[model samples]
Target: MMHKFLMSVYKEMLLLKRDFGGLVILFIMPLVLIITITLIQDSTFKSIHETKIPVLLVDNDNGQISETVKQNLNESGSFEIVTQIDGKTINEEVAREAVFKGKFQLAIVIPEKLSKDLQLKVNQNVEKILGSFGMEDTASVAQKNIKILPKEVKLYFDPATQLTFKNAVKSAIDKMISKIETQSIYATFQDQLGENDAPLFDQKSFISFKEIVPKVNDKEIMPNSVQHNVPAWALFAIFFVVVPLSINIVKEKSQGTLIRLITNPVPYAVVILGKTATYLIICMIQFFLMVAVGVYLFPYFGLPTLDVNGKLILMSIVALFSGLAAIGFGILLGTIAKTQEQSAPFGATSVVILAAIGGVWVPVFAMPKVMQYVSHVSPMNWGLNAFYDVLLRNGGIGEILPEIILLLLFFLLTTAIAIVYDKKKREV
Candidate 1:
């Protein structure tokens, strides 16, 4: 009796050892995918504009003031300028129409009336603030205060225009103020941005859309970057574990050993239990190796852990459960698949597609609506979100309970399907 159990376990181990290609994929492939995806997947690039914001510039003034504004906007790189000239594409109607096509996020119509507006408003604020200090309200007092944006600098962005895009316009206006000879004019708004003067505009502000810019929560709490990766990338990593597990199970079935075991006194449940147990162990080992190595070595890799010692242990158990769920899924795939050839491609393809939607490779948040909803079904998203809760979110076991339950549910459902499939296919 002992020999039979040992044989089964040993056969599983030997299968792993002999299939070195499998070993490479099971272990190394994940690390490679994680690193590659993490680098390109999230925006780490330090662009002033992290997202490409579209801008439409209508230079109604067509003079030095409008030209300066145009130059400043271009230099800001906060915009992808779509030039409209004369009545053709340059009109407000045309610019507004462009927004519907998803052509531009914002439109800047430089009214033919800009210079006079700046002269009037600049002097008014300058005289009011500087004059309040008991100084004469002279031309010098007005000159000293002309730093704020002129009222003529009108903005007509779609309300849907992002806050960042709106802020970019204001920032560009600020940069323009810095270029003028009068220093005191813009000094009042210095508390906002640019302690150092921006002499001439530079293209360094062009934000690469491929990179990720972090969003700060309302609270003072700022997290490490890994916690950020945990939500998306780790989910991706855990999901792909199924590919290896499925291939492992399909191999056993293909070699005729699974058929031979049915004739033995061992119950079918025991066979499934033993194999599932083996996979669970393999996956847990992998989970720890990734977490440990990621924490100690690849610090950039986002794999979070618990702050409370007990919770950390519980988190590991949760991860173990998630891995088991993945293995259960692999087993189902193996049983239903007529041959390893059929199983291998289908398993790999399923994971690749599902993981993509789950935000392992790219954030599921970034995926379109229907796919995002579909990803909720993927175990990777649940496991990854749970891992995030423990590590990055500083969440407790209670927070991850739903994820744990869902993972187990997936396991039970997949196992039931596999049992039915295996029973029917045994004769074939």
Candidate 2:
């Protein structure tokens, strides 16, 4: 079996030696991509905020009424208005044009009546909170206290705008509201009852600093980029790398080379294993190159530095295996695809979509709840999270065991499927 496996690896190596494309796929390309992505993410195109709401302000109430409304919103610090359109630009022409241009996420035309509306909403919401209608109406609530009604803030988002971006902004707003609400409640209590016998609420801390290596805040910043990014990217970068290489496999089969190999005294299992082994080696190299470059060069692009220690080493190994899983998955895809021309689009599309969901292209925290849950099935998310746990979370090897186990499972499953597929194909 060892002899057979060695021969299989040798055959794949020979093919690669002749083509020389494997080096680029496994090492050079992944490194280049890692650098590029790191640069884009770390660049100071804008300040990172807890939640930056791209709101448009149309201050129609130019007098103290509008100013008071603006002061309240600003004091909450829940949003970052991208454009502050003049009160004079409150016309339908300006509003429609701005909306079409996508200058802001939500538009707020502070109608001259905004102050009155807010006071009314506040009074209504507070009244609802107090529950003081009539004696008969309070019969059901006689035993239990009523829940605090959430402050009803109106949103004026353009429905035609990009849904994903819009949702992201909305989430920010929600987070901001949740954060400020505790304070708002406390302040209201203080105003109503003073420090005497009123309900005491601890003020929530604002996220003025992120936990980074420099120890910018109370929480420790993540130690390295590898833990933070590698797991997400292992599958992401390899998915891209696999498309071209896997398509080559389909090309070989279509050109009759695979069929010819089947008759070369080599077991079909051996042949398939050799191809997969080759891809694995290539992927391993890709993983190393991307990580090495990312550790040293990432800071140049404004990305946080990767920590180098036991944690870093372990993350690299686990992430590399994930890349191998991706390669095996690609091989399995190639074997099933039947034709190169037909395979290319499907393979590429699958990788891209999986990568996006896997948190390769974006932080999982940035994704919606549904996507976050859905991505759990993909190897990319596991790998990315493992890296994060190992590096950033300062997790030991034991902590990352689950991710490594998952990668091993993926490899075993894909390899088994590839072997079975090859056997069936040869039988035909």
Residue 402 Cα positional deviation in candidate 2, in Å, after optimal superposition: 2.7
Which residue pairs show backbone clashes in model 1? Answer: 43-211, 43-212, 44-212, 126-145, 147-185, 147-186, 359-364
TM-score per candidate, in order? Answer: 0.61, 0.65
Model 2 segments more than 4 A misplaced = 1-7, 21-56, 60-65, 72-96, 104-106, 113-219, 222-230, 251-264, 356-376, 424-428
Per-residue lDDT tens digits for candidate 1, residues 8-124, read 667677777887876667777666655564455344433446545667877777665777776766676655677753545677778877765566667777776566555555556
TM-score of 1: 0.61
How well is each residue in 50-99 modelled by candidate 2, as lDDT tens digits? 34555666665465445654665566555665433664545445655676
lDDT of each model, Cα atoms only? 0.65, 0.64
Question: How many backbone clashes can be found in candidate 1?
Answer: 7
Candidate number of the best TM-score: 2
